[model samples]
Target: MKKVSKAIINFDDYVERKNTDSRKWSMAGMHEMATYVDDNSIPLWVADMDYKVPTIIIEKLKKRVEHGVFGYSIPSEEYYNSIKYWNKIRNNWEIEKEWIVSTPGVVVGLNFAIKAFTAIGDGIIIQNPVYPPFKSSILNNNRVIVDNSLIDKNGLYFIDFEDLEKKASNPKNKLMIICNPHNPIGKVWTKEDLEKIGEICFRNNVILISDEIHSDLILFGNKFTTIGILNENIINNSIICTSPSKTFNIAGIPVSNIIISNEKLRMEYLNEIIKSGLKPIPSLFGAIAVESCYTLDGLEWLEEVKRNLENNYIYLKDYLKENIPKITCGHLEGTYLAWLDFKKLGYSNQVLNEKLEKEAKLVIDPGEIFGEMGTGFIRLNFACHKKILIETLERLKIVFGK
Candidate 1:
């Protein structure tokens, strides 16, 4: 792919987000326990990017807005074709039209999957520190959360496959949610790692739910292998939750593509959606956004975004090492979220939160919400202009640099 010129996409240009119903910029975006902040506070918490979405998507949406008739809508052939095109070109996976199920968001799809596949009191597995919603979805529906915690070897994280196998072997555990290019900690699972996970799920009668929302945000030469692209048997036994929302920074649009190749599982999932009275139909604008962003034209914008995110990560890592050596950040293999280790600061999670929010005036996702394993850490979203990232780093230095 050819490099995108700055003239085409000026990633460094700072865009104002405050007071625009922006979740990240609002005090409401923070945890209930967090300290209040004034206008000077910088929010690096939310997973959504601070940058504007691609011009191609903006133009497409504008055309639809001009139509001025907002009514009930269904997925178009163009929508399905766009999904197929993206997967084939990006992940090299060919998908059938019938296999695709449109969901409002990945979390919604997860809740429906849990309802469809497992009975009450059945166990659902997830690896943490991970996205917090994975645990909430299970408990909210009266299902069991069987945690297969990841091993933190130094700063880097690794899956505890042995523990996972034991959890899967148990008859009560009926499902497992694996985050590819995992959130909080930006570790992208290798093909071998995925194969092992798939084998465990296939053999144990556990339905695998692979959330690949961050697959397109891979950085620093890491590869993302979609679970659907694995062996035939594994593909039949798994569900892939994906979306262009994360890729193109249109997360507020609420669009996701949940792919299930197995006919029986797909039917069960659809049946659950119907029973719940929640139709999987995309909004007119949602359908247009997906169709617009999932094309070959969106590739240039994506590449440039990845590059900008990588540069931000590099800057954050280096700035910490030089200015505040007590804080350690792991290599960001994928995703724009940088997992920072602040245990060396000798502060409890409360103190850490206070220091960042109260003193530093930097609002970021405290690691504890991600799970117990994430305590003593922070998830900093780096998908912003360099100027914002620099200001964030300088704030950390002011508060934590003793």
Candidate 2:
């Protein structure tokens, strides 16, 4: 592994994502819309990083690609060991070999667990201004959503325990989805926070689904404690969804490590997966990516990535503060994402988002997409080179300059 300044990482050499029918890039090419801003803007909305994946992962993929054999596949014992090793090394929580059941992705695991644990109309709880997929997973699976809106104070995010407790105790609510080191807002819940959440869920009989996909992406100054490690009660109720995809810039690869410690949840979800009859072939190249990312050179590359995120976040914060004073992002504790609160700008969410897309030539995710509380906000992905970060911020300043 070579140590070099992340600023030297070239993003332009990265191939264009346009032709892949990427939702993050493609405007969907609707000819009927009067104003298609995606046509003009460079997208920073997607969660994927713009940096090149580590050389180790690239080499592993190359070896796999070189192999011409394409047949039904099974994850070897080493594959499962890789997942266990990652949890132990990065999360400080040793995973039982029996704990992990590979899934195609977290979204799929969420749906399966929802159906397996709770029936239709069972109330499911989630903190608001969270990852949009959490809400979608519940509703799309016919489970009711019980919003426990997080409290934001002075740019910091905290769990709304009063509200979460109320919802958790509700008889109709049977499941609560917890985003460990949450997305968009980037709050790495402390062990103390997880303690309260676990007790509340345990007492209320609410099944906890902990999405820890971003756990490994903790920024330089923060710590990410897995919810399952907080307490046995939480672990018993918890169905943890983790993947190398978000951490390794391989969402397109799509291999997820799904863990359910409780035998009941494990059995139920297993039944659902089989009933759904989804094929179980291993994602060969993706498997190689996960293996290399977790078992080899993961810690070293991870440290560099964390440094890159911290430096990028600081650059973004300084730029926005100096140029776009109205845009204030709260403390970003984990993940390379910044959640910008633009309420001071006095523009409707739609107007603000449109301005960014058109005038700024930047495709940012509007807060409204998260929920009503997200109306005055936008989620910015700063997981790119410093130069690109500077360009994105400068473009926004030019568009929103007073």
Report every candidate's CA lDDT: 0.89, 0.80
Q: Residue-wise lDDT of candidate 2 within 24-96, one digit each (tens)?
A: 6675532221164645577777788876777777776777778878776767666777888878777778888
Q: Candidate 1, residues 1-402: lDDT per residue as tens digits? A: 222222247875778888888777775756765766778888888898988887777777888889999878888888898899899999999999999988899999999999999999999999989898898899999999999999999988898989999999999999999999899899999999999999999999999999999999999999999998999989999999999888888888998989999999999999999998878777788898988888666887888888888888888988999999999997689999989999998899998888898889888899999999889999998888888888888889998987
Instruction: Report the lDDT of model 2 for residue 355.
Output: 83
Q: Listing every candidate in turn, what is its Cα RMSD in Å to the true structure after a full C-alpha superposition?
A: 2.2, 3.2
- Cα error, residue 364 of model 1, in Å, equals 0.6
